[model samples]
Target chain A: MVLPSFSNPGAGPADAVVAASPTAPLDAFLDNQPQTFYESIYRSEAACLCILRLLPPVCRQIVLHVLWSHQTLKSADLKAFCGMDERLAPDAAEEVIRPARDRHIFLSLNHKGNKFQWPLSDTFKRGLRNALTGLGTSNSFGAPYARGPRDEVPTAEALTDYGEDTWESILKYMVSSGLTNGYRGGRPRNSVLLLLYQSGLMADPYDRSGHNPKLEALTITSKGFQFLLEDRQTQLWQILMYYLAGKQARGENAADILSLFFSLGCMQLGQDYSASESFPHMENVLDDLEQYGFVYRTEMGRERGQFFPTHLSTTLCSGESGASRSQSADDKRFLILETNYKIYAYTSNDLEIAILNLFVNIRIRYPNLVVGRLDRRHVKAAMDKGIAAGQIISYLNSHAHPQMYNHPPPILHPSVTDQLHLWDKERNRLGAQESVMFEFFSRELFDETRDEAERNAGLHLALPAKKLLFVDPNVREAIKDFIKDKQVQLRGGI
Target chain B: MSYHDPYQVKASNGTLITCDSAAKQILIHLDAQRDGPQKFIIRDVDDTHVLIKSIYVDMVRTSLQEELEKNTYDQDPAL
Candidate 1:
């Protein structure tokens, strides 16, 4: 059986880690990483996290089974392991496993018997398993060991806003650091700057003149560019992990940090609890976490009191799928688009506007509203910058105009969406280049094949032009069948 | 068609007048009356064949049928 690595200060060298079970299979597998214990738990928490993050439960279960076994299991084996009563196994293999392998989380191989063998990547497996099972450290999820006053918790709304604010501050901090004197015209705390430097997201550019001591400027790196494009939830996790890695480097107890982060995810959002009481080692990290907006404190009470978690804190370690920070109501969009290319937004948030401005060419901005046109150049530029039309459309779809949601239409502005696609087509131009041609000696054969093609597939056959038959892109496969079937029928009847 | 006697009509001196039996039947069928203002038909049929034939044209068949039924009820108290 696998057991946790224990560190005893007086037993031997302080830096040495001692595993309880040397013979366990996982022992050799555990590398001397900065946060091995946390990584294990994080890996274990992977499936549960994925589940909570709103990934389909089927994928989560499959991931769990795959991550558990060291060997690559076949699709049939997965189906059996997940219990054969389900129908999603085949789809999970195709959609989840294949995509996960592409994402570098799973490794896929084709065996000799025409079967696929799948296994979770080592880091992903260990991290996910450790997280799900809460192995290694006791502090992975949260500690409800200490009691607190029942009435001290904040309301859900308060917690949500608090989370957004804190998370926004971290983002603002990053962006500001790239700007003049960074955002707030003041240097961030040394630890914050160090963490930023360690994450390699931004750099402090030094001047050539030795006399200019305070003339340092910050420049965002390429990684920062990609990092900023990710939604707030992902950015939050990245920053937190970055900070955690920094702490681990400082020889601070890594297990405690892991437990705290995982614990934060499991903590109640509104309730205030003493950090010193529950996690004594976390006292040093509390100020930083507060700056991250995970905790809030009130001084109006009898005790000099502890802070409570925000929704951001609670969701910091949320898994990838369902429990995504994006899925929450607070983060959902309230804008809809029309076919006419007229844009309407229903929010007054400046951050959202700033984000939208990264793509859309705004025509006008008003109080609580902004109107924009999705021009060709704008879309092309966004595409060039690694954003897809589908992502843009999905973003709009997800945050459809509140009024549009109240009075939904079959399609969100067919004209505007079509125009967007038309622009893409105009820029590419290869879409209209292809035409299909077929040769048949007999007119009777031609007519019969055409009828068959029309019946079997709802192909939009263009009116007869030349020797070519133009059909809708989706039903082209029917053409080959039609030709073969007609030849067979003619041969048989003769 | 055996005649009993030659009938003659008198203006000054009194004389017996005779009319055809078919013409008399038609006149009797055409000149009918109702007992009250509330009743509908202005004519009645004396012959059973003529009455049955004219039943389709009777405008007051509903009230007449009610009156007939009331007369039948009067005759039988059990109804």
Candidate 2:
């Protein structure tokens, strides 16, 4: 059986890029679904299009080739098409065919008088063809709402601002929940709060359950710290994955939710989609998604409303890096780090300030700039709260001011980065091991046991002068047997 | 010579501490204090090494940091 290329030793740099890319989690999530789930979801054109977009370029080429051809192609044909010979066939199979097959996009069959031929899954092929040619029922992609003359259509800029504000509020809540008394400002919806706790990103210090969990009682976990360091797209997907997993655990149908996400991914940003006509019975899910900033919905008084897919949903399967999506032009390079461990941020975004405050000691704040210093005490406190030194360093490096980039590579000052790393290393000075300490009465017995432990590669420490030996706990029984054998030898000799 | 049941074996989940001889001496001193019900050092292996209880590793590290901080010089300006 072929394994995913990411897990293989000889996987190329392209595979490594895909593995580190944001789409990797979505790809892995789809690959982990049961065959039956694929059979059902692949029937939708939107799901097929989203999944196709998520595949590696090589896999996409193979799928497109197989989709057009009626004949089953052998591995040799596939390798030749992908510009590889027999020697590289194994790599192609491992990298391309394995993942596609795992997702049920391609099926490897034993054809008559031919070794394993590849064919696209029938349902996936039909759905993808219809999606590309716009031939099938167009309901897979949400129906565009016909706006009335009196309806006020929101501009793209307004929609983007709305989505960002709603999203940033959730992040602010997570950050402030870690503060001493928590922020007294607006909190995200209770469903989001519950999802944060349920996803293990936040915990109640008092472990109280049932009904609304107090915002101050919640504390961000280590995973939450790591999540905060991630790009906005990754952060969004992480929450959605946790939500889907939670739904699955509660015995709810997650396939419907998955399909909805894929349908949203195929949607156009700022285009209004009719809720009643497009999603039918998924109004509650749509409302919940609106709360998470996936979509912006007009108020529904007595009739059905329309929802506009935000940038978050439109780029869900596009695999665009979060850096491009999250960074605004004005604040793209807002941070300036000095050799003396000082940081000057050129924006007034509260979320950025809160994130910087995770590891930096904020000294002063101005209208458009904030000055902070990275010191041992504050950094160590952040580390104590489970923020890694690497995350802090990367955050600084990624946000370095354009002036800093004017110099050569190593954008952040090397001294500052080195000092941060050293501070992190300081916490790992001691190493722990569970072992058995053997105190021998006779020098001969100690020597015998120490040698035995050494042969087994279980010796932790040995003091020949003091007749003491420390061996791994796992090898204690073997050491005892060796001692018994040595005692028998000594008795027989006497 | 009689071996007398060969050897006595004791097992524990321990943290192997390796530091300078002076730091080890400080650790030994700290372990000797009866400030808490539990001591830090499990056994002194050598001049520069000690086996410590894993549970007290953080406490031992903090105390060691505090002891070492007295000799270090700070050059950062007051904020």
Distance from true location, Cα of A365 in model 2, Å: 2.1
Deviating ranges (above 4 Å) for candidate 2: A1-19, A87-92, A109-111, A208-216, A322-324, A433-435, A438-494, B1-26, B32-39, B46-49, B71-73
- The 0-to-1 C-alpha lDDT of every candidate, in the order given, reads 0.51, 0.76
Report the lDDT tens digits of candidate 2 across residue range A435-458. 677777768777877888999999
Model 1 lDDT per residue over A86-143, tens place:
4544546455454344334555555657665665567666555666666744443444
- All candidates: TM-score: 0.47, 0.84
For model 2, residues B1-79, the per-residue Cα lDDT tens digits are 4335443444455667766567778789888884565776778988866888778877888888887767666555663
Q: Score the docking of each candidate (DockQ).
A: 0.00, 0.37
Estimate candidate 2's alpha-carbon lDDT, on a 0 to 1 scale: 0.76
Q: Output the chain A TM-score of model 1.
A: 0.53
Which stretch of 10 consecutive residues in model 1 chain A shows the poorest summed lDDT? Answer: A14-23
